[model samples]
Target chain A: MRLDKRAGLSPERCFNRPGLMKTDYRSRERRRRAAWIAFLIVPPMAMMLTFVVWPLLVALSSAFYRWEGMAQGEFVGLQNFSDVLFGDHFAALTWRAFRHNLFVFFALFVVQNTAGFLLAWFIYREPFGFRFHRIAIFMPVILSTVLVGFLWKLFLDPNFGLINQLLEMIGLGGLRQPWLGQETTALPALVMANAWHWVGFPALVYLAGMQRIPREILEAAKLDGCSGWQMLTRVVWPLVAPSTTITLTLLFIGAFNWFELPYIMAGLDGSPYGSTDVLGLYFYRTAFGNQSGGLQDFGHGNALAVLMFMFIAVVATLITQYLRRREIAL
Target chain B: MTAKAQSPDPLFPRSSPGSLIAAALLVGNSVLMLYPIVIMVFSAFKTTGEIFDAPFSIPDFTYVANFTRIWGETSLPGYFINSVIITGSSLALILLLGTMGAYALARYDFPGNSAIFMFFLAGLMLPLKLAVIPLFLQMRDFGLLDTRFGLILIYTAMGLPSTIFIMTGFLRTLPTELEEAARIDGASEPRIMLSIMLPLSVPPMVISAIQNAVPTWNDFFFPLVFIQTDARKTLPQGLSVFMGEYTTDWGMLFAGLTIAALPLTIIYIVMSRQFIRGMTAGAVK
Candidate 1:
């Protein structure tokens, strides 16, 4: 009874007394809340500002000047950006790298997303061992990309590697070549390796979307005499349009930012005559001198970085705006 | 929607020919996906000649020689410890601060909650890879250069957006009456958070934190850039170096890669349900 009374009556006394009890006591409550909000926001935000936001700004500003590791160099207006994009040989290298990135994007779209869309249907059917398949498929996604790079590099080794031996066993031995060491097969090889590492991500995402579809709609479409193909094309595809957008955007972004696989399989220079060079590896090579890129040009590196950011921001905006307009929201 | 009981379709057989095709496809894809991992595991045990000649055959499976060589001679153990430290400390920081920030943003009727929430979301799509140069410079300035502390801070901040984004979505789903009751009982807000919200929202939040942890543990880019010291390298960076030096030693290299991958693969298999649910839980809605 005393505890109940304390709980019930303290607030009444605190509120009814106006000046005496309310101001002194309730002010502390307000102060406590204000302090709580600040306590929560300040720490995480401070870290983001220090690392993510501030450094991005620094990178952007640093592009205008010709800065090295020691003494920041003289401001050269748009010289850095122009040089990285239009300078002798650098522009050719940039375009070649861009094409490789596009190949990565297109290859992922065809290999990963198509497989994902189909598997969502298969997994949705929940056949025997579907649950096990889902778990096992995502296992590689959980491993480090570095490890994936190493494992694939070994697998692609020309002599004793699994690829060559498998080709020989399958009676396709003549088709086998130096997979990661040839211009024709290098980018495609890396693309498949990347797809192996990440294909489950989209598969799961699309599966979740498939799961979220209202059963009533499916049943209604069936009632309307929709065939299997018609149902997939007319109803299910439209419903899962949002998943396609998310998957495609991530794929596109990942393509342009490609680094690890190429870096591991090819060297820092994206060797075999730079057939596998992507923007991320190219920027690193330019910024920090490698065997192919002779000098460390921080100015050109930052300019390339800024240019990549602009390309992403602009292209991402256009893609999302286009996709959002086409999305059939429920 | 399939959450409900399905009508018995007596007219159709359950295992139709089309599904037969799908089952075959599933089996085929599963092999393709697991093929390399199988190679990595078995090749670690097989003799060099056996690995080359009959790569398809299974090894004895009780291999200790390869493991010993890498441990005896290489720096794999040190890299593993560094990975544990970086992942553990960063995961702790992300969950603690990410949860508190998410709770406040979700619960309080603040002035700029929506704006702050948008800021967090925008961080997700922006490429952090592009900022490696300035991040290197900033770490140098703060005297955190080549330290685990530098990598820890970067991982923490880099993870905050998604962590907050997921946790906030989860926190908002919870009913508010419990929080109000706690408040009336004179439980401070942070106390309420610690005593109530954090515990209640842990499934989604920690899942988010684990999502962050997996990448941080496996990540090589940041460590490669910021860490110049050999002793400070994580598993992935160390693996790269080991691969470069031991380019010809397939046995030790396979053992090292298997060691790098084992902890995470075990977790994903054991907690696959929670891992999938936690991941999709954040993104689906």
Candidate 2:
């Protein structure tokens, strides 16, 4: 019936003769539907085209040009890209930020995703007070990243902070170095705070996936004398491949887009000797100068932005495709 | 099936050591999660000196000095009002324009139907911040810089893709009988959409609202870039500035942070189930 309507063939067409009035009515209805579709779809399409698509194209094109502030200078094909990739000052910063982004991606995968899966597994077991646990775990995920970042920044203060005070009380004061103040621990500390904030998201996703598993399959696995570890690795893990795909893809995008947390916790320059800098901070600093009197260079900034965008897009696509294939195979 | 006779539930073995261990782990994790926010609230009620002396102790509940100072001294209330305006307007546009687009895509089968749908879907993968340079320039040319309306437009564009995505998915699942009946009754298309279909789409609308509201309310990136005036700044950016000024006064800063976070935290607590469902709805399916 839907197909017939789309083809402009009403049910009355079969019984009635091929009359002019019928054709006129059908055409009029078609015109009305067309008008409605245009009216409905045009505004959003225009908005997207104006804001998202247009700027995207501009960013793509502007990267190859010499930009002095906002004004576009003469076209310098790939000069900006070369500078961003291999210049004296920017090359080191670029690689450092890139490495930091990779480090964050892996750290979050190991710490956050693993913790989330474990939490999901616990909830799936339906232990006593699981309902309360579910809500409590996700509490931090709802708060703004700024709030989480500030809260952790305060907690990690070397003096008069919760972590340090607790450490002294428990006779572990020596271990309480400034978490965000040092080079080695700064990035990891930011990652830990982020993990604390977002681990609940993946937990909920994994829980939803786990709940969809047929009970009979689990019962059968148990009846087969599958050990607990074997059951988890062989049965549950493979079944939740799709959920893993979702979580990992989002994690990758989020890792590369790591801005607000690091920005808030460790200042815009990714302070503590630039240990916490990521591509996001780099792009922002390049485009708009920091408090340290760095000059804004839109040319290099656009180049970096383009590179980040392409890298994320390509890797995310590949990750999603690979995981989806794995899901299909499993 | 035969295992059911010996064990009532083979999938979940209760009262085991492993279950006890899992419960303990969960409780520990919950404590780790809740402890910091609790400390923040506690510190908000204490003076800076008191906070330094007893970081862990609960403060006097009657202390309203921090709250009064923040209310009277800072521009946080203005920031809060600005956030309300920006988020509310952005949300309205996101829903209205998103629903219209989704309805058209789901209900109609015009030429380029799939193309337009894919166009919206592509917005999901490309983070808009990458285009900030061009967007900044465009906003300036359009005379929208430093304006709340500019932020609203940006947010609406940012939000519409997901809103349309979720709404379209939900609208497609709805049986077409109601629409068909309305059409047969000679009702206009807008009437059919508003009266018949829109009412049935409350679930997706709510989901989209919550999903979009959190980000719109919490976003500091755009406002930081576009909104230069202190009066126009939203909560996150405003709190960042407040933190900078009152770095020495931990109590006032905590009070400001608490004020920024309290509304959403309360809403989340009250409607946590819906919040979870809304947030995770996109990923689960």
Candidate 3:
């Protein structure tokens, strides 16, 4: 064996004799490689554990305890969960917020994802000015959601807003109302704003999927006398099933984690009789308290958060698995 | 090459009725998308009364009074500086630590490698906002509350998962010959990482940077919970408070919004391909 002195030890110290040389060198290299791996990976892993994993564990455990303003009082078992899921006042608000979230999810799926898909389809045809249209559609997606929510709030203002003025100019003045101040229109307005902010995302995803289609497949479909509608519904839709799975799962998560838009546009109370209240806003109010005299109840708040996390995780996984199963291999 | 070149026409002919309909729909959608933003920019140049009177009319582009007022009077400039500091610091840490972790995972065949990768991947599915209560309390205990460094740490932690994911994927695609050569030349592992691998990983670095930078720059929730001091507030939370104060001053609000949005908008317009690719990288993959 060639004795290599560059192993950071004298050959005599590293191995007792020549027979042990190869094994010592191999084991030393293995230890060195393991040390390097640990060195590189441990910082980020520790950061994740400290900030993410630890907080998650604390959130899970804190739900089972009585809390007095950031101080854990006693281990109350599942009482907090019961209070959030079934307590008199909490149950009604929880149900209302849950219903609003469902509405947001359905509305976003219908409006945002549909618009995105249609836009993607149109752009995929490479019509006149398609490049500019691609950029324009995605412009809003790049802006902060806070900015979009605030802008829409100003636009939907009753008197001095642009929407009302435009409605009057276009002879649709009768349709103008305080969109965010009313019970019926508030939730829908929030959904529309969110759709405007995010439609381009799914559009681009679908467009990418469309571009991946082989040219011969299109030719084959055309040779089979497929019309445009048939081509889209039959060929393109199934082919982009992976993108659909992604967009739908993300939409489900975003819908349940809905806070910023509603909080910005409609206020934390989700006012006009809580028409816009979502589980996110409800969790915030319960945990942090609001200007509307809601008390900070960390126990129930953590419980609600745990429930929200589980619901989203389970449903998102199921949706992903279901859609992934349906995706065409090609 | 010539035979392949003339193989097939596009799926839709340009003159067809269907193509025309597609064109019209696209144009209409583009208008729907761009008009509000244009109106916002124009209203930023007009007084509130003028904005109310002619909400859709083009304003004189020379009108800079609202901009001047927002720059001079509001705390927006301070918030802008704070956002820069926090985002810049957090991005640096994320890129550094993320690339290191990614390099280890991509290059080595260590035991438990896939398990560690899966551990990081789990962060993507679990939104950290769900654990705000403990995070808030922990920050308090660590004496990190209301400090920019606390926000930086949280953002770095929050950003590392996707950064590592993107970087690992990209780094794996790089040919191993160069790294192997560097290894044979007696370069240390970290030297190979920093000097060899990282230099070759710029595209994914940019992608990861843009992806994390946008969210870090625009995040409102964490600052709302962690930052109570006015001086440390980032743009989103600061603008929210500023909006509350200037509720009736539509021009000023628009100016503030414009200032808050201008950086990303310019970056997006310039590097739109990268922005789109970066933002959608997770989902598209």
Candidate 4:
């Protein structure tokens, strides 16, 4: 890097030096550079490969083999994948779980993002008590999902719960059904719990993005007599699209792979007629024996995991590309 | 009408009637959001009968009975210690390795630099749970299953991508003249990074630390599958099982939840600015 002639270590100086000396200097410099690169790259790269990348590769391969919890297993050659995709009970279970995931996804998309967008809009203005509001909204994000699930379970308790009690107080007791106990309401109930837990995140992100838009453009739009709706639709919305992209991309992955809240709220087996079953819980159940079944099939588990991985990898890439392109165009 | 929402001083000093309505609605909504947690904390101090009697009443602050019971009876203290160990160790490793990688990538152009950047960035939204099936098997093979050290390694590895991404972005924005001067004055690359860059990189370090640490602490899934023993369980996993077993014990459960949440809640309140800044750093950038 030191090209100046006045420098102590110049390429020209090294080249002009005597043969063995020049070779020694060049070799030493090369070695030092190599060491710097190696020191930086080796640890992080190795860890990612060993723990993350390599494990996924192993999962992909394992999906092809029939293995229980054992050191030795039979090679089944895509049988697991076929079974997961088309086999009788497993296939039905997979699709049923898939549909629930879609419902969860749709609910979160509408509830979380819309609420987030609205909250961010007001908070972005730095209105009175905005800081308090922001803190209040984001507080849940840091709590353990276990606690969130448990708290909501208490809140949704049919007999002694807050939601039902509030309904009774408001003379709408008839509208209050068993939120988590029935088939029709269980998935939505789980989704509502999840939305309650995570709604603040997208709001914060959106607020941050909105903060980045130049104040001049906003003022200029006001001067041009642009309505507030126009200001949002034409200006703020376009500018905050990146945050939208980020939120939706996360939603894409999380909704399909949703687990913890449902697991805690419902159970491992997606009790209440499997209404709250998601790929994550279902995959875990398939891999490990649950109350309904006593079979722990590693091959099928790996296959399901691989399917999830593929779906996320593909959809995540597509959404990113699509959103990023829109960002550039805007 | 609010003064700021439409005041038109090039700052959108919103002053519209709609803005007031929106603001009021926002506050109401935020209150609704916070209502449950409020109930939880208040309920902890209430007797089961009192909880049923006046569900949302202010708690009797003098009553330490529920907390005392939880502290004396439960294994929550052990789980707290376990969580601290796991989160702390993982954060330390993630920062160390992440910053090292970022420094190298930022300073020198290597083969596959962009490719490597893409590889790490791709981890941003990857559902790591998908890899759990094999990660478990691998951990089993390595005798890492049900161990704190195992959780630490996996978490450090898992968080590396986002940590590196944030750090690398931060490092790139810093002026290179200082590094150049250090090199000319006979400082080695590691020395330059450690002595100069590391201190300069503190803000991003804090951000990534919070980013990495919070999730690692709150993570229930990894510990759920990895750990088999109640003695070795992290807080979230342990709390889940504990809550299931103590379903009818509302006061103890709330007390336990409060205990589990207290440390993080305190940290956030104390460092609210930094916490907010750290959490929003990624999205804003």
Compare the candidates by TM-score and give the number of the best one: 3
- Reference-based TM-score of each model: 0.94, 0.95, 0.96, 0.93
* Ordered list by lDDT, greatest first: 3, 2, 4, 1
B98-139 per-residue lDDT for model 3 (tens digits):
988998899999889999999999888879999999999999
True contacts kept of each: 0.60, 0.70, 0.70, 0.61
**Candidate that would win on lDDT:** 3
Question: For residues A1-330, what per-residue lDDT tens digits would candidate 1 score against the true structure?
Answer: 435545543767666766766566767768777888989988988988898999899889988998765346999999988888889968999988888888888888988888878876766656656777887777788888889988888888899888998899999999778999899998898888888988788888888888788877887887888765687778888898888877777777778888887888888888898888899999998877786447777778889999999997888778777887778767
Candidate 4: residue pairs that collide: B4-B13, B4-B14, B5-B13, B5-B14, B5-B15, B6-B13, B6-B14, B6-B15, B7-B13
The TM-score-based order of candidates, best leading, equals 3, 2, 1, 4
**What is the C-alpha local distance difference test score of candidate 4?**
0.84
List candidate 2 segments past 4 Å from native.
A1-20, A328-330, B1-10
Q: For model 2 chain B, where is the 10-residue window of minimal lDDT?
A: B1-10
Given candidate 3, what's the lDDT at residue A156?
95
Identify the superior model by DockQ, candidate 2 or candidate 4.
Answer: 4
Listing candidates in order, what is each one's chain A TM-score?
0.91, 0.92, 0.94, 0.90
Model 1: pairs clashing at backbone N, Cα or C within 3 Å: none
Docking quality class, candidate 4: medium
Tens digits of per-residue lDDT, candidate 4, B137-166, equal: 789889998899999998999899989999
